[model samples]
Target: MGIYGALSSAVTGLRAQAHSLENISGNIANSQTVGYKRMETSFIDLIPDAPLKSQVPGAVLAQSRATNNLQGDIQTSANETYIALNSTGFFVVEPKVGQSDGNSVFAGSNYFTRRGDFEIDKDGLLVNGAGYYLKGLPIDPGTGNISGSVPEVIKLSNAFLPANATTTINYQANLPQLPKTAAYNSTVYNSELLKIDDFVGGSTTASVTGGDVLVGTNPALAPAGPLTAGTSMTIEVNGAPVVFDFYNGGTYSGSGVGIDLSGGKVLDDVLAEMQTGLRNFGGGAAASATVGLNGAGNLEITLGSDYYGTFEVSGAAGVDMGIATGTASSEPTRPDLTTISADKADAFVANSVSGGAITVYASNGAPVNVQMRWAKVDSAAAGGTDMWQMFYLSDSAATGGAPAWTNIGQDYEFGSNGSLVPPGVPTATINNLTVNGVLIGDVELKHETNGVSQFADVNGTVTVSTLNQTGYGAGEFLSVAITDSGRVVATYSNGERIEMAQVVTAQFNGINSLKRLDGGVYQTTSESGEPIFDLSGSGIIGGALESSNTDISDEFTKLIITQQAYSAGTRIVSTADEMLQEALNMVR
Candidate 1:
């Protein structure tokens, strides 16, 4: 029994050493394989039951252990689909079960793998070098969000992306404080600009009862009694405010200045004073204004050709001038350059100043050049608001056919701070907007709070900081790439980049306990808990690959040790056989 047990122990030793050698050989063979884990053989001694003083010799059993958790060296690759895991996780994948109609059919069972040499196959399926298909959640094109929770073999669409109509446009820009345009009326009135005296049925300067009638009337100019000599009157013009000092009437102050009423004092006297005050308010020499009566018996004050702004009149606590009572009236009509006719529109564009332009896509995928021109219609004096109108031309041929600028019909008003004052919703809608004969329905312009503004820029230039429209023309599939965060993005020839899908990853608590499959893939086992899906993990690296964890030098060292142990096991078997033969001879 003792000889037989020794022979049995020697045989077990030989088997255990053979297992170790097998593991070492496997490790060495897969040294260059991507995502290959090294297998280590563990030996355990089996002891037989015996008395306290005596012990029985034991054989060794070899158990193969997987070093799956060990990280591999990462190397960058030019292939966009090649990905590497820097942390403890594996890419969820699926293997093809069968082929149907020349297409690979998935078995539906999820597998985990570190191999990520994925490339888009003919069927648009992301297949790795190991013949495993990558699984992930598809991203919705409209919402740009992950659509499904259950992972499936990620398939890309090579179909052409349809065109999108221009729905909403986010625009941000600054309009010049004083916009230069041909339509801006530098002169308030083309003819005799005047201030009328309805009290006297004539103008203060013109003894003749003709000209544009001043709307308001003043009291009869009678001889004054003993009164205070120091009284003041204020008139606001184009935002510039000026004060005029008035003395005891019949005659006021400034004997030789243009405001002097040394002659027969009438409405003309007050008109002269207002004109002089306004001229001085704007630095006098360069500034000029005329005051007289109009055909309607109204007081009219017209600014010079270069000075187009507002005006207001008010008196001090004790002033007696009838002119200083209420707010002044602006110009009758504001000038507009946009005409309904095409030829006139072209002329307007040729003569008028242009602010900025942008290329927006039409509904039919045609590029439309939208030229924006800011036309100063009237200043604060002209219309009680510093007003400007922006016009757009969608007609491709502005010179050939009737090139007309479609009026948005909204005046962009500016506050004193150079910021935009929303007239209503601060949005503009273009109805039936046709560019190059393509009817691109109603395009909404989003010009909320900060979308558009007007400030005093020395350069007098309008800058469009941001101008993006939610629209795109039809595009052809160009290429596909993966992001570090595991998002698969597809680019198109029409300058459209869409997120196609997101690569799914899984981590297990007992990763080494998972059942190993062919080609470095693992199947979920009872010992290995269910796959825990992770989307935003920091392990995935795109355009790179993970090298095998097996080290050739270390595997070769183990191989040498395994060879020596195997040889020793053989020697033990031979010794056991020789001893058994001797025992048999003694029996003989």
Candidate 2:
């Protein structure tokens, strides 16, 4: 019984050592495999019933232990789709079972794996080198939220992305406090401002305008003021020139700069005298055309309706006010108060500076330029703070009465502080913004808290701070990428990045109890319980891969120990056989 016990124990030792050797070899072989977990051998003792005084060593059996909890080195990969897990979880995956009707059929079975060397296969499915397809939940495009509880094989399509109409535009800008439009003359007052009549169209009572800041009687108006004892000014009425001299003293001397004074009399001095001097021009409407100050203390000239010719004002002094400089041309009877024609795009453009432009798509993917222009209609000088109207080209080829520019229909007004007047409306929506007859649909313009303002800019131009529109023309699929959050985003030719799917991962209550399958995947075992699904994208690192947990040096050391144990087991068996043979010889 003793010899038999020795032999049995030695045999079991040999078998157990062989099992250990097998596991060591497997670990060494898979040392370079990505995401491979090393298998370790655990020996269990099988004790036979014996008296306490005659107890002996037990027989052993070797079982495989999972190193699934061990971490591996994370290495960065050039592949955009490669992913690695830094924590305790496995990527849920599936395999193609067969092809049916030109489409590969998937086996609905869910497998879990740490292998993340995934690449887009020809079928547009993300598959690892070992042939398992990645699974994930679909993400809602509108809400950008994960959609489903059940994970499915993620399939990407290279189809063209449809055009999105311009919806919301984030806009930020600073409008010049004083816009120098084309009609503005350095010589004529308030010429840089948008004439209210120009946009609204119609000036039954033709008039020339000045600003509200200065009093007509104040000889110290803009351009150059605080007049000298003698200063000369000339004005035209119906193509005829009327000259006058200014005098600050009560008595006018013939020692003045220009002519036409009575009784050595300057009719009631100041600007009123200049107006009286112009009345002698003998115009058909000369008597009716009155040059006077308006209620706001701003100089205004009512060009009577009977006047058929042009009017010009020039001065050797600053008598032209802050309106013009040097030589000048005749101002229009009104401010070209007619609606601008499409052919007059150049003229309108000269009058209005660029508000910036963006390309927006229509319902059918037609693209059009949303050209914006800031046309200042009134200023502080015209009895109000700066006011502007935004216009976009309605049609480039519009003719006759057909409109050219479509007003955004909001009069953006600014305070003297250069900010929008409060009750601050930071956002405005252009309902069905149409350009060149292409409907861009309703678009919200977001200024985002004092985003639009008027500041005194020397350049006198609209400065755009931020401009972006949520719209894109039809685009072809370019490529796909996985983010750290486990979202698969697809990029298109039109510069749109759309989330395609969210990768789903699963964790286990007993990870080591998972049964290893072919191609580096694991199946659920009874000991492993049900897989707990994880969708938080924990420990997922994109653009990298996890190396195998099998350490070569550790496996080599175990291999040496297993070889020694196997040799010792053989020696024990040989000694047991020798003792049995010697006993048999004695019996003989």
Candidate 3:
């Protein structure tokens, strides 16, 4: 009984060692496999059912212990589609069994894996090296939300992206408080501001004085400081110069040309002096210069006449008093966009400044360049707050009797503080916006609160912060890639990237107890509970892969130990055989 029992125990020991060796060899063999979970050996002692003191250390059994919970070292890959799991989760996948009617037939059997060497196959399906297809929830292209609860095999579409017409344009800009239009000259005072008559044909032309802030002095509107030397202003009436030269106070003040400051001389006295000087000029009578204070406190002069030439105002002040300058013409302007005619398109371009441009799409995927211009129609210096009317090029090549630029049909008004007026409508609709005769449907120009503001910009040009439209031209299918956002994005030829599917990650209650499968995949067992789906992309690393968990040095150590243990078991067998042979000889 002892010899036979010893032999049986030796046999069981050898089998157990062999099983451990098999596990060790597999771990060492798959050391370089991507996402390979190393398998460990667990030994169980099978003692004989006998009295406690008589029970012997009996046979041993070896079992595979899964290291699925142990994470492997994460390595980065150049492929954007490759992904790794940082948490104790697996990627939901399925196997493609057959093809039916030019489509792939899947087994619908859900499997989980950590293998991340997935690449886009010829059929536009993401498949790993193990021949398993990635399963994910489809995402709506318009709403960008996950469409279904159940995960399905992801198959990409290669259809062309349809053209979308311009609907809403998100625009934002800051209008310069003093716009430097093409007609503006910095050396000439008030040249940066707009003149109302420039846009309104046959309208009364206007101008403003720069130097009249009321002080508490008796002549409250007179310049506070005594007139500086060489202070003079010139008004050119049809080539005649009426000069007003300033002199010290109380020294025989002249009303025609030279004027004395203070000494009971008020702002009205200065205007009276300017008016008298204008009357003295030769052709000044033909052009009436009505000089007074507008509502904004700027001394203004209205020029209303049949003068062919311009009524120009230029000056060099001795102090900080604002003076009227810049050439204000009465030539029924077209470049100012006032006397607009179909044949006057060239003049319009010469007056207004560029307000930036964008390309909008038509209904048939046709691209059109929508160019805009900012033309000031009214000004605070002209008895009202600054107002602007925007225009877009409708017909670039319009001939006689045809319209070229069309007004957007709305006015942008600004307060004195460089901001839009109260109850400001930041948004405007460009109704029937036609660019080069391409009738783009009524496109809405959405400008959020404070989107359009009037501020002091030295550039004196519209600064476009955001100018994008919700429209895209047609595009062909391009490529696909994955992101850390846990979404599979497809790129189109139109420089558009759209999310196609959301990768779903799953976890199990007993990760280490899952049944091992071929090609670094696993199956659910009675030990491993049902998979818990994680819609939220947790522990997903994009553009990277997970390396096998097997360590070569550790596997080599275990290999040596198993080999020695098998050898020891063989020695026990040999000893038992020799003893049994001797006992058989004695019995004979």
Candidate 4:
């Protein structure tokens, strides 16, 4: 029984030394492993009952256990994927198997690990080298809800989508008012008038009876025959009217043949004819009425319903056409022309209810629809452009019929592709114009795709110029770091930081009690307490790995100790065998 006990003890010693050597080898092998921790072996003793007088007892090798308190050095790498736990924590990985509830399987009832080197799979799932999917609170794509079962793997490549394409753009500008002289006018007059009557005749000669006949017998006009009565004739004295008659058979009828005796020129019959001749000698026979000078050279005239007056002869008539004064009537006021020249169409007072539509080109020169609401009406000034208040709407189709004016308190600048230009700016051309909310014209835009570009005012025109170009290239991977909250941040060449995942850390009550599993992993057992959830980088020192705690010198020393122990155990077995052999030989 003693010999058997010695053999058993030697075997136990050899096995324990071998186990210790194996542990040391493991520590040395994984010395460079991130988050790896080294382990040590411990042993217990066993004793059997002894007799009182003999005072001897047999000792037996007992169970060997691993020391779990070792900590390892931490290492860092430039790779963002490389991570280390600052505290006790395990990465939760889910299997591909479906859950009994018919949902996707997660780490809730699955496995855990310390490996954090992960990448996104083709399906945009985050996964590890073993194809195990990392688990996290699931996120809803639409509502961003994070309450469902965690996905197996997170896909990194498909993390971002393209930005929304610009559908429409609005442009507005005031048009220079046209000059006032360009206006047209309208005035007219009557061409013709209506006439009353028409007549054509001359005085007649007839025998006078109880009617007077005026005649003159001068050598210029002598009556070759008997005078006649009822002879109506036009007198030349002051262009007046007169009546005369001649008696038959040379009879002189005083009543019928009477002439003006005021000039002492009278003739009955021939005498009257002679006076008539004298009176009508100087001036020609009158047609209608005439104004002339009398023989006395005094202004003489006939005042009667059918007679007209005559004026004395003069060199020329000086007539004063009355000075006609026009009444001061009000004239419709014309809008200020000079000031209007500088005013843009947008500056006009807009009474239109429906905002106008303006089509503007985007940075890519694509036409975009924009709705412009009336902004303001500013008068033109020297060295300053007339300002107009303009607004835009997000949804033109919904609010186009009646666009509401945006509050002025909000500041607004032309969008990235837009620009403003004053009047007479040669480089800057008017892109669009609106009047009373009416879109009058369109503006052309110039743009560039690369670099930071801005529109600048150049001589009242807009010109797009390059500003700067920094970090404007395809994105590249950059450094990464873990936060105390366990968040993994991956930085990019574009100065963008992405939150990769929350490093999960797990804590077990008795880490030494954990069962070593394949793949440098550990499994939970009844002795090992349940894993307590925590985050990596958190100061909590639970189940987290402290890298390979193996010091090079310490590991080498342990290796020597293990070899010596193995040799000693073998020697003990050899000595026991030799001793037994000797006893057996003596018996023989």
The digit string of per-residue lDDT tens for model 2 on 402-440 reads: 778766767788888888888665898877788777788
- Superposed model 3: Cα runs more than 4 Å off: 1-10, 46-59, 187-189, 202-347, 377-383, 414-426, 575-588
Task: Determine which window of 10 residues in candidate 1 has minimal summed lDDT.
Answer: 190-199
- Residue-level lDDT of model 1, residues 247-271, one tens digit each, is 5445544532233333445666565
Lowest lDDT 10-residue stretch of candidate 4: 188-197
TM-score of each: 0.76, 0.70, 0.73, 0.43
Clashes of 3: 3
- Preferred candidate (TM-score higher): 2 or 3: 3
Query: Model 1 — TM-score against the truth?
Result: 0.76
lDDT (10s digit) by residue, model 3, range 1-588: 398998998898999989888888888888889999988999999988999778889889888889999999999988999999999999999988899998899988899999988898889899999999999999998788999999998888889988889998898888887787777876653455444354345454434345544444444455523345457777665566677787665555544477776565566777667666665562532245665555555555544432123456676651245654564534422234422445766666665667889999998889999998887665665334577878888888888757888778777899998778878866899998888778898999988898988888988788989999988898899888888868999889998888999999999999998888877788998899999999887899999999999999998988899899999999999999999899989977
> RMSD of candidate 2 to the true fold?
10.1
- Candidate 1: where are CA atoms >4 Å away? 1-10, 50-57, 101-103, 174-232, 238-270, 282-290, 293-312, 315-356, 374-389, 396-403, 409-429, 446-459, 536-538, 571-588
Best by TM-score: 1
Per-candidate Cα lDDT values, in order, are: 0.69, 0.77, 0.77, 0.40
TM-score of 3: 0.73
